[model samples]
Structure formats: structure tokens, C-alpha cells
Target: MAKKRKVVDAKRDKNGNITDVLLEGNKNFTSTEKALGMTKSGLIDLVVVKRKDKEHLRTRPDGKKGNNLDEMADD
Candidate 1:
């Protein structure tokens, strides 16, 4: 089964980039790479996309902005 928890929050660096994300039930933030790994392993519900030479995680399309990576980072 796919993971039910979604990224509800985020942790960012001084550059204002999201370095980590917080799951629905997780109190501590998890690295984006780890989350990406989980997404690859079918443990978490996400998509891996290549941008230039790097892979990034994105939420499945649901026509909602609340769960978008950018909004989550604003929290």
C-alpha cells in the first residue's frame, strides 16, 4: 500500500530552499532525498521527476495548491 502521509510542512536552508519535509504524523522533518527514496520504493506517494541533471520529488496531481511543495515550504 502507498503511504498515506503527505508532506504537510517543510524545513528550508538559508537560501530559502526546501531541504526537508515533515510528514502528516512525523514531528521531525525528513530529508528530501530520503523522502524521494521512499517515493521510489513505493513507500510514499510521490513522483520523481528529472530537472536538468537532478531528480526532485513532486506531489501527485490533484488540482490543489495546498499540498504543493512551495506552499508546504511556506509553513
Candidate 2:
């Protein structure tokens, strides 16, 4: 299989919060902004969430649906 490529290179502030994101590959900030209908700076608000209330979200008996694909789709 071919190795996966990194899609974003993040720049963080002094507090370690991401302030900017440089998209990898052929896409530039202008192109991404145009396509996404928003400025590149708008993407800085992206958050990573961890559910502390629930051990897991999925309730499938087989446990196959708890994988990464299912989690990503929920986002």
C-alpha cells in the first residue's frame, strides 16, 4: 500500500494552541479558502474532542462499528 500523506501542517501559539494551518500537497491557502468559502484563518477554530462522560459511543454487539471509520463519519 502507498504511504499516507499529511494533509495539514499546523502552527501553534506560545500557549500551544494552533493559530494557523498550512495545507500540504498541491493546495495552497488561496485555493483552499476559495473552495471552502472561508478564509484559512477560519480553520483555526478546529477542535479535538474527547468524551469523558462515555467510555465509548458505539453500542454494537459485534464491536466492529467502533472503529476509526465510524468515528470519523460521526464528525
Q: How many backbone clashes are present in model 1? A: 0
The global Cα lDDT (0 to 1) of model 1 is: 0.82
Clashing pairs in 2: none
lDDT of 1 by residue, 1-75 (tens): 654567778777888777898888888999998998888888776788999999988889999998888778874
Error of 2 at 6 (Å): 6.7
Model 1 spans > 4 angstroms off: 2-4
Q: For this target, which candidate reaches the highest lDDT against the unseen true structure?
A: 1
Q: Write the per-residue lDDT of candidate 2 for residues 1-75, one digit (tens) a residue.
A: 333222244334476433333444635432322323232224322223337752221112344543322332332
RMSD of each: 1.6, 12.7
**Ten residues in sequence with the least summed lDDT for candidate 1:** 1-10
Report lDDT (Cα) of residue 26, candidate 1.
Answer: 82
**Ten residues in sequence with the least summed lDDT for candidate 2:** 54-63
